[model samples]
Target: MQFRNELDFAQDLDQNDPLRVYREQFHFPKVGGKQVIYFTGNSLGLQPKISKDYVDEIMKDWRELAVEGHFYAEKPWWDYHERLAAPLAKVVGAKTSEVSVMNTLTVNLHLLMVSFYRPDNKRFKILCEEKAFPSDQYMLKSQLRHHGLDPEHALIEVRKREGEHFWRTQDVIDKILEAGDELALVLIGGVNYYNGQVFDMEAITKAGKSVGAAVGWDLAHAVGNISLSLHDWGADFAAWCSYKYMNSGPGNASGIFVHEDHLGKKDIQRFEGWWGTEKASRFMMKPEFEPISNADAWQISNPPVLALAPYLASLKLFEEVGMPALIEKRKKIVAYLEFILGEVAETVSGSFEVITPEERGCQLSVLLHGQGRPLFDYLMKNGVIVDWREPNVIRLAPAPFYCSYEDMYQFGQILKEGILKLSTVDSLG
Candidate 1:
């Protein structure tokens, strides 16, 4: 497709976009009485207009049924989360039995590690990417500490080669082989939050398991953004926050995937809780814990209906549009965004380096070489919503669900103007 840096071209693309209708479903924040061109869906998704309706339904059930809402409400609080398992499974490419909605991302990761990250005298080290999301970094360190191990010794980070911006698949596989018998687990962000690179999960999982290590993914930036096949890839476990591309609101309920091999097993080591027990026998008051026959066995508490409401609502959108359609739009839209960025770079004196590789989802992390925070501030003030990282990188995630082609074109124009203006100011000074 020939790309053009014109309003008419962008509008023509948007007009023909099959997924364009989805943009109207979300409520965008207005700046200066105009809707902002949002590119931060990689950070926090815009709230779905239907999310309120779902929340209201749960609220009405609570108000009218009171305590009886647990079993008697329309979406019985006892199993409200079960409704999410099927759709969430489709989004992450797993069986319904392998997926469950539960606590937040890092919390679920800690719990999953209890079962997957068993260290021994021969195998005690864990492998992950260097400069992982800060929460993941802290979680890995604390987990190592809890097991009486020093992070400096037990944590193996697969770093980018010398001045590179991305991790090569072979580099990670080679690292896994080097760790060999010493590697206990391999946990990494499926889609890196910094460079927006999608790791080769299938190959990495194979490599980790070959070395007698467990494999899991932090899919915070991956889920609802890229294609996944956790079950087919033979991943032991995975977890993700839904507030990003999933649009489940801020810090909402997380979804987890425990492989079918791990499910229905009483011998597996996991923290026990009343909610994790069998549904029929939960209220029987029996002392013995009978784990659920699925991923719900990892759940430690009853469903948070209020939180799950938005999630379920969001899943409805996924079910309607499907991941295949979403991915189709994602590829085209991201390519268009890349094209626009290239066009802008050509027109501006400032150097723009897109560190995000071709194996990416919706995000394009731009390294602004001759720009800084003031340029970012200029963008924000101009009603272009994007995410800024340390040093001088801005993350622009044109989420296919809500971001339009015109938004990409407009962002290019705004970005070009900001760079030129900043360059002018520097010259004058």
Candidate 2:
């Protein structure tokens, strides 16, 4: 489809968009007393208006029912997190029994490692992408250290080609094979945060498993933003936070997926707690720790219904639109955004190079050569909300759910103005 930089063209696209109604569902931030064009859904999603109703229901239940709310309130607090299992499973392409909501992302990853990352003398090294999200790097390093292994020898990072912006799938597969008997685990962010590149998880998982290694994904940016088939991919485990594309409030609960093969295994090691015991026997005060028959076995505490409320509210939107429809709009809208960027670059004095590869989801990481923080400040002052990385890069994520084609066009205009104005100031000085 041919995309034009004209406002009418963008508006016409929005007019026919099936998901356009969703834009009204969110509350956007105001700058200079007007709504800013939001482009940071990769970092934090806009809050859903209905999220308040979900939170208020929980609050009202507490006010009216008190302790009895655990079992008697509408949507009982005892099993409120269970309500999310089916819908959340559908979003990530896993069986309902394989998915559960629990602690934050890093916490869940640490817990999952207890079950999946068992290193021994023969196979002790872990393979991960170079410059992983800092939390993940710390988690992996600390876990290795706890096992009495040196990070320099136990961690194998698959570095990108010297001049490239993304990792090649074959390079990751080759590293897994090269590690061979020494490889104990393969964990990586499904979508790279810095470059916005979507790794080929299926191929990499297959390669990892073939090498006798446990495979998992940190889907912080991938979940709700890209299509995933964790169960079919044979991933041992996966975890993601809900605050990004999932649109739960800041630092909310996380979702986990564990393969069916490992669900009821008695030999599997985990950091068990009361909530992980069988539901019927939980109140019986039994002495033995009989694990739940599914992914909920990973839970270390009672589900936080208050934090899960907004997440369930957001999942309702995913259930209504479905991923296929969302992906369809995502492809067209992102293509249009790329076209607008190219058009703007041709007109502006500054060079804008998009580092995000074709295998991306919503984000486009732009390398703004000869531009700096002043240009970013100019965009923020003028009502364009985007993410600025260190040095000279801006990350723009046009989420298919709430972001519109007009927002893309408007961002292009704002970005062009910033580049030209900054260039002029530099020249005059």
Candidate 3:
């Protein structure tokens, strides 16, 4: 698929896009009365236009039905979380019974760790990627401390070779088996937040289990952006936030996947709550905690209908377009972005290297060597909404749902202008 530097070429692609109509479903941010080219779906997705209506429906239910909305509202607030199960299951590639929407991502991560990260003396180490998102790092550290173990001694990180931004797949597998009996759990991001490298979860899971350890992933950036097969991959459990690629608004509820193999295990320890109890005896108020038969057992609280509303709004788009179609669009647009980045390098003084790998979904993490915030500021002032990472990376994700090929082309033009300005500024100073 040869790509051209022409904006018209990009427009032609968008004109033929089957999912082009979905761009209208979202409301883009505006600056100076013009729409901003938002490429930050990897950080925070743009809001869907219909999300308001979905949330309003829940508000109306609460206003009219009051307590009875628990059972009588359109979705029945008591089991409202159930609404997203099947759709989210499709997004993450799991059985309906294997998926549940409940707590926020890190909270769910901790809850899952309670069941999966059982570190015995023989297997007391937890292996994860180096420089994971801070929340995951903190969680792992605190979890180790809670068990009276030291993080420095109990945590192992898979490292990239010198002079590399991304990890090699074989290196990760080697680390998993290298730890062997000493590794109790393997927890990594399904798609890396910094480099946008999609890990080979199936191979990692197989390696971890072969060495007698539980395996899980934080799918925050992978859920809607990639085709997942968590059930087939044999991951013990996984969790993800819906706000990024899922576009469920800021800090919406998260989705969880507990493999069917672990669903019926009564001996697994968890923080029990009323929502986790069997529906048959939920209102009975039994002193005993009889957990639900499947992944719903991980639910420590009932779902928040208002917050969960936007999930319904966003996932409907996913159902309509399907991941396969969305993935194809993602590839085309990202290729266009990659092509444009190359064109910019011919004119810009400083080097800009892409850290994201070919296995990545939509994001391209750009390393702006010798140029910093000035370039990012220029892009922002010009209504280009990309995210900046510490030290020097800028993340640009052309989301399949709302972002178009024209947006990618325009972003390249804006970025080239920014680079030219920054190069001149640095030279003058």
RMSD of each: 0.8, 0.8, 1.0
Per-residue lDDT of model 1, residues 41-74, tens digit only: 9999999999999999989998999999999988
Instruction: Name the candidate, 2 or 3, with the larger TM-score value.
Output: 2
Model 1 local distance difference test score? 0.94
Q: How many residue pairs clash in each candidate at the backbone level? A: 0, 0, 0
Indicate which candidate wins on lDDT. 1
lDDT of 3 by residue, 1-429 (tens): 788888899899989999999999899989889999998999889999999999999899899999999999988999888878998898899999999998799999999999998878788899999999999999999999999899999999999999888898899999988898999999999999998999988898999999999999999999999989999999999999999999999998899999999886667898889998899999999999988998999998888888999999998888888899999999988888888898887767457888898889999999988677888888999999989999899999999888888988888888887777777878898
Task: Give, for candidate 2, the lowest lDDT window spanning 10 residues.
Answer: 345-354
Model 3 RMSD in Å is 1.0
Candidate 1: which pairs clash?
none
Listed in order, each prediction's TM-score against the native is: 0.99, 0.99, 0.98
lDDT of model 3 at position 389:
93
Give candidate 3's TM-score.
0.98
lDDT of prediction 3: 0.90
